[model samples]
Target: MARQRVPEGPTPPPAVQKLRIRYAKRGRLRFSSTRDFQRALERALRRAAVPMAFSAGFHPHPKISYANAAPTGTASEAEYVEVSVTERVDPERLRAALDEALPDGLDVLEVVEARPGALADRLQASDWVMTFRGMPVADLERAATALLEQERVEVTRMMKSGPRTFDVREAVVSLTASPAEDDTCAILRMVVRHTTPAVRPDDVLSALRAVAALAPPTPPLVTRLAQGPLQTATATVADPLAADQAGDGT
Candidate 1:
């Protein structure tokens, strides 16, 4: 066998700073897959002239890390990504430039210089809101109560490998249903922990159907309201980038 010669070249510059960005997938953009967002972001970085750090390999790619992306077909207000840059950049300036470069539906809400800890470690739980049109609040409340009463609720999801069944009850930190302002629709709010197999909002809905025979007339509009460290006492999600922001003295 003939030996292949290794290509020699100068290595890419080392990353000087890391930044954490909080962005939203709203409107029609929520339906885009993770790969779609990744490509869009890379393009935006290039168009915005961001000083992104590249990997030191033959096919070098930008060093961008995504943490706990929301499922496709669902809107989210708390999507997060971290980027390494070859040159230090002002977080706000970078955010503005990228936001302008990207499409309108994908909004950049905030950015912070990363601290020492990993950003993924802080995303312990997520808060979600599901809106069911033409469904009465009373019915939703009953279903939520039934689901909460259950000791265990299992749901199945089709994975790439095969059908996987998992218990969603343990991951549910809080679940509540109330009437929307219109009174004709119902809103369900839930807090779920980031667990193995990952209990999604759809999984909770499946559990509701199994436990209380709750089925909406129309597809529910699901949106992730928050994703961060869970505040035990308040049963709410705190900002994941707060530590980084504080560290940066911003």
Candidate 2:
């Protein structure tokens, strides 16, 4: 039996989207929050005239997504952001365009274009460098030793679901401290959970306060050593801890 067949039109080609982007951190601008960064980035993208994809609506804005944002006031050498555009563009040209529009301190190191539907889990980990100044060498050693001694150190986490506790040990895949060659303060290198159960410089600060007696009630200085995997980016130091991570530049 031949049923009446309805004619179907040809399938429309998938819309090509282009994302011109660069990652940035708000150092000493912690008050700005993640929303602030997004606003600034969108503004920069439009100002740079980078081709962008916009959602259809009365009021529309370019399509952009930030990978993972660093906490404010903490400088990071590495970060990630993804942008979407309607047209394909060269990475180098896109980089140059964004660079011109961005101010000093904000840099676009790479502009690689990824195809739609591609898995965004390409990034693995981020390296953070913190300075715990004024902590005596003895106290610094004790805190680090205590951290490494146990298989897991339960740390309370603040979540919308309510207060949750997680093992900082498992997340802290690597940790180390050393005397700087040119500086008087101690250098701490840490790689903690990024995707979930995110840790910050303040956590380490808390540990130092608890375990070290000679340590200061407050840190003298703090800086993000580097963020993102080592292979895709550079590191602040070339120590053994960072080498343990599969993706961290060995």
Candidate 3:
């Protein structure tokens, strides 16, 4: 009788550094749920040979923390995650490696060494761009006006408990409509405050429908442009990765 020999390799080093990453979900990958993306990221980290940290327990898991995940079925350019790694790798190099490892549409845009303070707390609001196909721009503009005039717009969402109604207007910091490709397709840009339940793009669309009877022939394509501390003076969100990028000089 003969026993098969097992090969042994050096154990992975402990994760001592935390790196924050900004990635995108585009095209078909936008349909992937949070769980689906998490699994994909884990696989990508392995494939890219990212020295990710693991928890200490019977069932050890990677020390990856996702912050402010955009809702499923929506494309985004600013999705963020903080990953603990054993070695200190250059952020740009890490970004390139992960981008190459992951699928095409699920792109890794930026990677930065995590700074002090919570990423969630720094993110006060989100800038969303909604594209409406086969919908008049004028109708969307009118809807925005109508919605702004109203003090509150309530919408019902099906929660774990049951259907819960909340005011969508109170969460809206600013909403404006403009032309996209043509008159039939309108682009709506909105900066919405992060609320308790989180008012989504659909919620704002529902409010538009209630106000000015604005409806699209097809489902609107929604993309989150950015999420960070909102500048009251200019009405824009500061780049969450700016501080890290500045320090890296890349």
> Which candidate number would show the highest TM-score if scored against the true structure?
1
Which pairs clash in the backbone of model 2?
A: 18-84, 18-85, 19-83, 19-84, 19-85, 28-73, 30-72, 129-225, 230-249
Tell me the number of clashing residue pairs for each predicted model.
0, 9, 0
What is the alpha-carbon lDDT of model 1 when measured against the actual structure? 0.93
Tens-digit lDDT track of model 2 for 200-225: 66665565454443356455455554
In candidate 2, how many Å is residue 44 off?
0.8
Would you list the clashing residue pairs of candidate 1?
none
TM-score of decoy 1? 0.96
- Please list all clashing residue pairs in model 3, or write none if there are none: none
> What are the runs in model 1 whose C-alpha is more than 4 Å off?
1-7, 248-250
Which candidate's lDDT is highest?
1
**Per-residue error (Å), model 2, residue 124:** 2.4
- Candidate 2 ranges with C-alpha deviation above 4 Å: 1-22, 26-31, 57-59, 115-119, 160-162, 211-214, 225-250
The lDDT per prediction is 0.93, 0.60, 0.87
Q: TM-score for every candidate vs. truth? A: 0.96, 0.74, 0.90
Per-residue lDDT of 1-250 in model 3, one digit per residue for the tens? 7996644554446887889899999999999888988988999899989888887645578999999899999999999999999888888899998898888889999888876666777678899999988887888889999999999899998989999999999988888899965465789999998898999999999998988888789999999999988877777888877766566422
User: Which model is ahead, 1 or 2, in terms of lDDT?
Assistant: 1
